[model samples]
Target: MTTDHLLYLCFWCFRSIFSVITFSFTSSVFAQQFDQQYLIWKQQQNAHDLRLESTLTHQSAEAVISKKLEPKQALATTGLSTASERVNINQANVQQLQKLKGVGEKKALAIIEYRQQYGSFKHIEQLKQVKGIGESIFLKNQTQLAL
Candidate 1:
């Protein structure tokens, strides 16, 4: 072969080998990057799963605790007595009136003052005329109110 031809062949072979090496290096870098991204995603997924499990565990514990309580204990925790035992708003004292839902000391006193001024609630709905007793409070205690 001529020297020029041999030199040209050598250059072409070198170029091909160089291209293959560069392609292999770029592919390895891409594979490593993909692996790193996958690991990060996996870690995030595991953390989310742990949070979900913790929430479920807390809910389950609350359910168990509620189930273990006595009926009176449960009622007291909810700030109510037996549903059958209702409050007579017309005659109830401040402490007794406070048994109604949302009726604190101030609200109970307001109810007594209203009753004294207005001569007694003619109807259960008249209890709403008290200063702090709006529709929401009246509705919450509707079932527990007596004439």
Candidate 2:
């Protein structure tokens, strides 16, 4: 084969190998994350993979790992709850709201104020109506929310 052809073949081989490894790596992380997500998904479980299905095979392992880990860091920082724990927007106190991914004191207060104004949240989806929350934040906590 030509040098360029040989390099191309080798590149494809490595790419395939890396893709396979990604599934393995992400599976291990997912396993660790699973037990935690399980409880939450149980309460908020949807056709959206209550069975613990993962889409990591389509993504770079690094990206998949980072995305999964991002939401839990704040919960970890507080050292008071499991990594998969989610705040109940309807029942959460300021401290609980602050434990969520992007919420700080101001955002937590906004959430409480919103809850009071609206009464109990009609659904987890209603969190999007809060001042600082949007689709992205709501989507990130999909498993953590409850009705």
What are the lDDT scores of the predictions, listed in order? 0.85, 0.74
Q: Kindly give the stretch of ten consecutive residues in candidate 2 with the minimal lDDT sum.
A: 51-60
Q: How many clashes does each candidate structure show, in the order listed?
A: 0, 0
**Candidate 2 overall Cα lDDT vs. reference?**
0.74
Model 1 alpha-carbon miss at residue 15, Å: 32
lDDT of 2 by residue, 72-127 (tens): 45335434457457667789888878766777899889998998898999888888
Q: Residue-wise lDDT of candidate 1 within 1-147, one digit each (tens)?
A: 999999999999999999999999999999999999999999999999999877765655565486886655555445447878788888999988988888899999999999888798889999888898999999998998998
Candidate 1, which ten residues in sequence have the lowest lDDT sum? 71-80
List of clashing residue pairs for candidate 2: none
RMSD of each: 14.4, 18.9
- Candidate 1: Cα lDDT at 77: 49
